[model samples]
Target: MLLTQADIDGAVGDLSGVMRRTPMIASRTLSERIGCDVWLKCENLQRTGSFKPRGAYLRISRLTPEERVRGVVAASAGNHAQGVAWSATQLGITARVYMPTGAALPKIAATKAYGAEVVLEGTTVDEALVAARRYAEETGAVLIHPFDHLDIVAGQATVGVEILEQLPDVDAIVVPLGGGGLLAGILAAVKPRRPDVTVVGVQAAEAAAWPRSLAQGHPIAVTAMNTIADGIAVARPGDIPFAHVSRFVDAVVTVNEESLSTALLLMLERAKLVVEPAGVAGVAAIMSGAVDLSGRVCVVASGGNIDPLLLSHVSTHGLTAAGRFLTVSATVSDRPGGLIALLELLRDLGTNVVDVVHSRVANGLELDEVAVTVSVETRGPEHQREVCGALSEAGFLRE
Candidate 1:
């Protein structure tokens, strides 16, 4: 059933002491950029490093003593796994979390640390979910789905209640859409209190299913779900959350890979916040100008559980997108002084050379020519252009 205000209120009361009331802080940088009074609901700092516990704790808490004795089984990429594990540990219930083989190592470790028996299974969440279902059926364990449940949605809706309480004059709210539990919950809570407030939902462009689902008037599956934002990489929207999204969410948009990376980096550099790629969907949407940045907008910073290796890769990509880093290849004379001369010119132009590879055996190179691929740190787009112009003027042919 679609959640009502009473359900959300009950969830807020139920979640007290169980969940931290995550802060809503003003972001001056985002506010200036978006031309609105921007605020961030910092759910990333919530217990278990995400908002998942809000729903997970509530869902497990509602289970009967007999059901708890049967134990709980769940499949998740990361956040939900930790949530369920932590919640079940507190409730003294056994939780078996099936995670994809490729799931982030940190997430898997954290889940296990929280007292869950973690089973590393298939390559994707959906595939791992199959294994989890089999385990549940065989063991008579209750399957705690990541989303798509009345109680879970009600639990997630408590975030909206907190948001409304924190930012009473909030004109708009932007949320990251995965299975739509968070979005559905927020909508159920806020829409009833203030129906005029605009609620926008964002998804990774590569894995988005909402646009298509809304178009076809039913939940439709995407062909592929490969994305850096693995947290929101659901192939199909959950039927339960879809019902709420259709009724309440104002707009659903997708952010490309580059935009997602840039947003993540921006949050780290400007806000000193380590937001996961999926968690920064609202920021990505606002920064990319995909969402309407009207007055007093609050974007939910959903989670902060990101793999360090992935963060490094995304940071470099974000630097590239922002024109802070550049890679250029050029052909110069094969003489020793040729490479030195190119380096001198770059140094004179204030370009910091990060790495350089010089080779004469590259395909299409002339007998007297060598190919030099240089990766440099630049100030911005203008510095990159200046570096390229200076190289071209020095008779280096860019490749």
Candidate 2:
């Protein structure tokens, strides 16, 4: 069914009490960087740490009493699983969630904590979704799809409506695209009221489907999807969302892995927000100049349910991508003083040493030589270059 403005509004009304009114905060740092008034729609702070409940609750609530009695099942890497679990608990219905075997530990724990029977299966969300479907068929349970239904689209549309209410004068809405539910819902709600408003969808370059699908005039599934943003790693766009996105979205932009890491770091260090990689795709687009928004813009931070271990890795990656971190290897004298001297040199050169490792009896090491590797923190790209040049000049940098 086509998601009309009236349907979206009805969802908004239905969700007023159940869903949190997530904040829309202005970003001064981003505004200065992008040359436009920038605001963040903090859905990462919403219930279940995502915008999923807006749609999940609305869809489940509309179920007939008989359907509710049979229980609900869903497949998600994390966010949507938690949403369905939380919503089901609220409505006094049992929930069973199928998650990928490699899904984040925290998300799996959270989903179970929200009172769902958690089943770990497959290696990807699509695989888990297949399990959900079979369970639904076998047990007569309601399958709560992550995205793809009319009610789901309408429920997510409420986010767009809330954005317009919070920032009526905003000129553009930048949404992170996965299955296109969020982007489609936003376009349905925003474009109807403000036809002039620009609605753009941001997708991860590694696993993006909208660009290819839009070009081909049909939904095409991507194979071997791999990206840090597991939340938005949809292999294909849902039919409902694909139709809405094709008709109403002004533009769709893609951001690479480096930009995504950098944007997540920017939010953590600058905005002090713990946003997931998928949630920062919109910010990544702005930071990387993938999308040029010349007017007031609101970038939706779609989720915050990130694995801490992954965050640790992404933080190092972000630092390296921003030129704030570096690793160097060299051959040094096989003595304790040699390591101390290298550390001193780094300290004198205004670089902070993060870690140091040494190895002897290696292929390239002589009897008196040891392989030394150092990880250091720098200020920026120029600073890193300067440090590397200094090390090279001192004959301590290997290649």
Candidate 3:
């Protein structure tokens, strides 16, 4: 079904009480760095910690009473599962969510916490979706797809309506695309209203389907799919979304793992927001120079349901990418006073110690000599260099 502004408005009306009117915040630091006005659509703060709720609620709300009574089933890796589960709880309906076995722990816990029956089915979303379909058929429940249906597209489009109302002069919009529902809905709504605005779709480099799908003139299942952005790691594009994307979207770009990590860190440290890898793909594209934005740019932070352990790792990865975390190995005498002198030198260089590991047997060091590994936090690359130089000058030879 072709999505229209009327559909977007109707979805917005249907979701008024159920969903939040997520905030649009301006970024001074990003604006200065990009040489243009930058704003963030903070959907990471949305109910269920992702924009998936917008589409999930809209689709589920349209189901008939009989369908709701029969219950609903869905297949998802993370955000979509939580969205459907939360919507089901609100409507007092039963929901069964099928997720991949290796799905994030936080996503699995959150979905179950929302009063849904959770099943760890397969290693891939496609496999889990098959199981969900079988369950839906065996039982008389409605199957709520993540991004393929018209109602889902209509619901996701409501975000575009809010964005245009919040920033009338929005010159560009960068959105993360999975099956194309979010991009389709936004383009269907925004392109008609503002023809001059550039709408850019971003995808994970490891699981990019839109670019290939567009070239093939139809949806093609990707051969290999792997990425940290599990939220947008769709193996195939939806036909409805592909039609809208081919017509309305200005461009589609892919971002690498390093760029994704960098963007995630920037959001956490600079924007003070916790965003998942999929949530930061839009920012990743901009940071990696994949999509150029010369004027007003708005990046959609899509979700924030990242596991704490994964968040911890991504934080360190981001810091390492920014040269804020520095690791240095040195060979020092196994004596206690030798380690004390190195610690003093690090303090004198204004470096904050993060972690330390001492090894002698592992590296085949003599009993009198030990390999001291230190993790330090510095301001930037320059500061990191200063720390290394100070260690060398203190006669602690870095191995």
Question: Which numbered prediction scores highest in lDDT against the true structure?
Answer: 1
Model 3 lDDT tens row, 231-341: 999899988899899988899999988788889999988899999999999999988889889888999998988988888888898899888999998777888787888
List the pairs of residues colliding in candidate 3.
none
lDDT of 1: 0.93
Candidate 1: which stretches are off by over 4 Å? none
* lDDT score at residue 238, model 2, on the 0-100 scale: 96
Q: Write the per-residue lDDT of candidate 2 for residues 191-264, one digit (tens) a residue.
A: 87899999899999899888989999989999978899999999989999998999888999899999999999
lDDT, each prediction: 0.93, 0.93, 0.90
TM-score for each model: 0.98, 0.98, 0.94
- Which window of ten consecutive residues has the lowest lDDT sum in model 3? 390-399
**Order by TM-score, highest first:** 1, 2, 3
Best by TM-score: 1
TM-score of 2: 0.98
lDDT of 1 at 141: 95
Cα error, residue 334 of model 1, in Å, equals: 1.7
